[model samples]
Target chain A: MLKATIDAEIFREAIEAISALVPECRLHTAEDGITTRAVDTANVAMIAFTLKKEAFDTFKATKSEIGVDISKMKNIFNMGGKGDLISLELADNAQKMAVSVHGYHYSITLLDTNTIRKDPNSPTINLPGKVVISGEDLNNAIKAAAVISDKIAMGINPKDQTFYMVAEGDTDHIQREFGKDELKSLSPVEARSLFSLDYLRDMGKVMSKATEVEVCLGIDHPVRFSFDIAGGNGHVEYLLAPRIEAD
Target chain B: MLKATIDAEIFREAIEAISALVPECRLHTAEDGITTRAVDTANVAMIAFTLKKEAFDTFKATKSEIGVDISKMKNIFNMGGKGDLISLELADNAQKMAVSVHGYHYSITLLDTNTIRKDPNSPTINLPGKVVISGEDLNNAIKAAAVISDKIAMGINPKDQTFYMVAEGDTDHIQREFGKDELKSLSPVEARSLFSLDYLRDMGKVMSKATEVEVCLGIDHPVRFSFDIAGGNGHVEYLLAPRIEAD
Candidate 1:
């Protein structure tokens, strides 16, 4: 059994973060909070999100796992106005969830977990390069790179003490660098990786709303983005594998 | 020879009005103003637009005909910001037009007039039923009808002195009525016609910005929508042929 009431904006932010990588997820709910860890179908990206009890106006639940359709949740949230409160309730062993927002009630049938991929274990790796920057600045770099190329390379310049993003087109290229003065903080460890713009474009949109995001990088390794939501009560992390660079 | 400088917003509005119906047009320029009349490729809808000299900050032109690619003009206008001044210059008998906006200069090759459709003559038909209403309201009705059916019926009830729009779906229907209070004015002549929503949906979007739109109707005849642009200095009329109602 679970019952929760959350600010509409906060709930939308959480659902949008998860929907960026996967259409469905197996959400685990407990007395303390709710969490989900899922990988995209292509295995190139994974998203892990946690919303603590503090994120909600009221929360109560027993330890349980339920299948959620992230896309359906996005649709329902689209009907809500800013500052609206959303209430959700699910009875023990029930197949349907009740959602109420803005005077509208919706009964959504939960997807069967048996048909979804099992949650994958988070990989263990060390990324020596770390940088904390404003989410708007990071998203701006992603958008600028997308205008010129389908792939972007991100790395740290230890000598310059700056984080740099570069996208090379057949005849044109764009490069942007963020120095210590521009970033909240930076660890200038040598790191470089190429990533597909398709994934970053969608991820950038969701990250744009965040105040600050921590980006971790390593040579030819996955890139990880971590940020806080719901005024620090919730957390979201995105891990995206690098694309092999072509000679 | 022609030289003109106009507000970017006014220019964008004119281009958008023409682009909604046709990709290319034979534009007529005179000392008084500029005008264009053309039908869509499908020949089901026609657009006639006029922008008076009063709409421009500076205007000088003689009687001339120029073929314009509406799509290309739209792309150039995309670079302009609100209230920006745009300048256009063309030499007599020249096939290229120079357009400058926001410090950027673009030389566009004009389409050959011989390749474009000849100006269509405005049909001589009396539409006894007329109603003047807010453009936003009209656009809203068109959008609401599109949700239920591919066609919508618009008519005036002489007895009730009301204008009504209706769309009937296989399982449902929607009706919206505008009375004297809601409309600026009404002729209250009994008239009804079924029109394809495809054309109206596109035209409605452009019309929505106008403060007032005049809708003229007739039984089994085409519908004509007239509105002012450029703060009353310019005018646009859209005539859409009716679709035969299936029994």
Candidate 2:
């Protein structure tokens, strides 16, 4: 059993983060908060999200697991205005959840948790390079690179003390570099990886609203993006596998 | 020979007006200004436009009839920034039109005048009922009606002293009424005609920017919309045939 009320904008941000990589997730609700961890069908991206009870205006819950259709939730919330307050209620062992927002009430059938894949184990890896930068700057660079190629190469130049994104198209290339002055912080150990713009584009749109995003990378390894939401009451992480760079 | 420079925004409005009904037009350039009149292929709608020399920053031209690809011109101008100035040049008897905006230069091949349809003669018709309204308000009603049905009936109620638009969908309906208080002026004549929403949606987008639009109507007759652009230096008129209204 669970009941909670959250700001529409913050809820939208949380759902968007999960929907970016997967269409659905098995959400675990507990007394302290709620969490979801899932990987994309292609196994190319993984997302783990946590929203503390403190993030909601009012919260009460018992340890329970429920399946959530992330994509469908996104569509329903779209009808809500920015200043709206969204309320959700679920009874113990119920197959449907009640949602109310902006005077409209809807009953959404929850997917059976038994049908959902078991939560994936968080992979362990050592990423030596890290940089913290404004989300707007990171999103802007992703958009610029997308215009030039289907994939983008993001890396840290230890000697130059900078983070750069480069896209090379047929007979054309685009690059954006950010020095220490532009980044909040940087661990400038040599790191470079090529990633498909398709994945980054979706993730970038959600992260764009974040004030600061910590990007972790290693040589030809998966890139990890971490950010806080709900004014620090929530956290999200996105891990995207690298694409092979063919010279 | 023609050489002129105009604000990108003003040029965009002009192109959008022409492109609304037809993709190409035989543009008539003279010492005074430029003009074009074209009817859609189905001959259900007609557009006549004129831009005066005073509207441009610099203007110089001789009597010439050139075929302009309206849709293409719209695409080219999309590259220009809001504050950018668009410069156009065409040498006497040249086949190419040089367009420069924001330091980028492009040479567009002018269409053969003989390949384009002759300018349609403006038809003479008497539309007694008339109303003058703010473009934003008029366009808003059109948009609202589009969601309800494929056709809209606009009319003036002499007894009520109001102008109104009504759309009846299969299972839904929408109506917006503007009494004398909401409209700038009204003729208050009993006039009503059904029109396809497809055409109005495009025309409404262009007219939405105009300060005021003059609408002339008649029972079971065509609707005529007139508005000024380029700060009164230019004028545009749209005439659309009424669609058959069935009970």
Task: Say which candidate scores most in DockQ.
Answer: 2
List per-prediction Cα lDDT, in the order shown.
0.91, 0.90
Q: How many clashing residue pairs, candidate 2? A: 0
The 10-residue segment of model 1 chain A with minimum total lDDT is A99-108
Candidate 1 lDDT by residue in tens digits, A154-235? 9998889999999998889999999899999999799999999999999999999999999999999999999998999999
Model 1 pairs whose backbones collide: none
lDDT of 2 by residue, A1-247 (tens): 9999999988998898899999989999999999999998989999989999999999999999999998999998876789899999999999999999989899999999998889999999788999999998888778766654799989999999999887776534556678899999999799999999999999999899899999999999999999998999999999999999998
Model 2 chain A: ten consecutive residues of lowest lDDT: A167-176
List clashing residue pairs in candidate 2: none
Those runs of model 1 whose alpha carbons end farther than 4 Å from true positions after fitting are A1-247
Q: Residue B47 CA error for candidate 2 (Å)?
A: 22
> Backbone clashes in each candidate structure, one number apiece?
0, 0
lDDT value for model 1 = 0.91
Question: Alpha carbon lDDT of residue A191, candidate 2?
Answer: 99
